[model samples]
Target: MKKFNLFKEIIITDRNVLTEAINSGKLFGIRVDGNICYEPFTLDDILIYRGTPDASLPIETIFGKNYQVLEDNDRVLIKAFSNWQEIIGFNSPRATYDDTTADGVDEFSTKEMENIGWHASEFNIKYRTLVDVLEDKCEGTLICIEQEEPYQFSGLGFIDDLADARDVLFEYCQREIQRLINEDEDYAQDNLNDDELEAAEFFKI
Candidate 1:
């Protein structure tokens, strides 16, 4: 049981990954008051929470505080990348333009460029799943979802990138499935009476 401090900012993009996380009984989303309010949130809820703008807040408030997650045991709080600012904080640029825009050529304002640079410098990339990392399609250091015992994505628990992580987890899952199948076969053989074993052997031909 590893621990992660949910108090830090966290990002999740794929809805399916989020859903699986919730169903896995490992993660939870809590409210500001320290109560688990978001545990029942669905994929649609997360999408809406991430997409809808909070009119009550100022425009500068990039990350919406609508929904949040908490580590199941430690009660560590987690926030979603609900806006462009939060996304950029993860080293992902908001947008890019070529030299040929309809209005001739567009350029990022000095302040915008500065913000981008700052985000890259302070980026704390984290991934919810191997698939989420794969979809990112970029190579960089990131943190694994395991919070209790933290490890660098590029070291120790060592993953080259999202693609590598995806392949490794997939292979692990396949091996586990096969292991379960073998266990079932062993249990059947152990429990079967003589007549059942004879019938099973006959079918084996």
Candidate 2:
């Protein structure tokens, strides 16, 4: 549940240089069996560079919208949603004022509750939500989704399906953790009660 470190994985889900990038360090490297391995590293390699034979492109620009890059080099700001346009408004004073009151004292009077109100001023700007940007754009598109995740000491988290790619990566980490624990010859005596150890031994074989 806790990620030790964050790593940006620029995954190429197609037949592109993603694999070569991993293999060559021009893209990324992952852990395997507790060891940092590069591309061409098989599942057994701990640092695996696995993928399909197709390549996908980045959605720098959407069909009808343009994204503004943010201070964060990898992040961008999105103004409009799928169908909704952002609007704003401004508050101003009215032309006429009413001085008649119960105490005969002058008070503030405004038109339309304020001098001027704009729909645009009323609305606020928005950036694409993380889920929206990543999910919507990369859903079924055969492209490489790039984002950061936990770092691994060994066992690569290479995946093909960019959508469920995190699941694949996490699975790799879990398996690697289990492998290391299982490989520890002293693991049996280091932890676990007699009953748990007995059950583990029964299942170990």
Candidate 3:
């Protein structure tokens, strides 16, 4: 039983759109009263809410609100990188305890847990997911909508509903590129020997 309110609820007005989104295996979003309210995730997200009347709010009741709005969470850990190189660099994969987030540990395999020994299932680890980490890193809203293999994206959920995800990412990329360039230029200027710096300054137009 969910407490219902019309002004702030997620309901599907059309079943055809829902079916198309799920069946196409493509990203789909629902706009409620002119705002992007809900997006149907994989089958688990679709059916896991209840046997019937599983509206957007029900799913949100479980996993949407906290991660959707990261500020609500008491525990926020953000990791900083030196530059864009570090942000997009290769990362070595390892075992993770991603059960604490609203999405929980998704699609993690038993074989992947071999390192933890036979007591793995008996021992449950509740910790931060990448979305939690990225919110701290990017300092913006990040959305994850993929139903299958949620972790397949770069960060847990790199999404922006404000505009388009593509537009948002592009803008971020441009800003970071300029920031990195400026950082490198500043480092170069600071590291110059006094004589070189003086000479360079003198040569400046």
Score candidate 1 by lDDT.
0.32
How much is 89 displaced in model 1, in angstroms?
13
- Please rank every candidate by TM-score, starting with the best: 3, 1, 2
Model 1 C-alpha lDDT per residue in residues 1-205, reported as the tens digit of each score: 1112223445333434444444544434322223332434431121212223333443224224544544344333346423323322321122221111224212322343223222222111112232232334433232222233564121111123434444443443334334433566642446655554443343231
lDDT of 2 by residue, 1-205 (tens): 1111112222222223233543442334322122333444332331222222222424233213322212224323222212111110000021122111233212212222121111111111111121222233332211111233552121112222332533432333334334544775544346655544443343332
C-alpha lDDT score of every prediction, in listed order: 0.32, 0.26, 0.29
The 10-residue segment with the lowest total lDDT in model 1: 91-100
Decide which is better by TM-score, 2 or 3.
3
Local error of candidate 3 at residue 115 (angstroms): 30
lDDT of 1 at 61: 44
Candidates 1 and 2 compared by TM-score, better number? 1
Off by over 4 Å in 2: 1-163, 186-189, 192-205
Candidate 1 — which residues are off by over 4 angstroms?
Answer: 1-160, 185-205
Q: Write out the backbone clash pairs for model 3.
A: 42-147
Q: Count the backbone clashes (under 3 Å) in each candidate.
A: 9, 25, 1
Candidate 3's displacement at residue 188, Å, is 7.4
Quote the positional error of residue 32 for candidate 2 in Å. Answer: 30
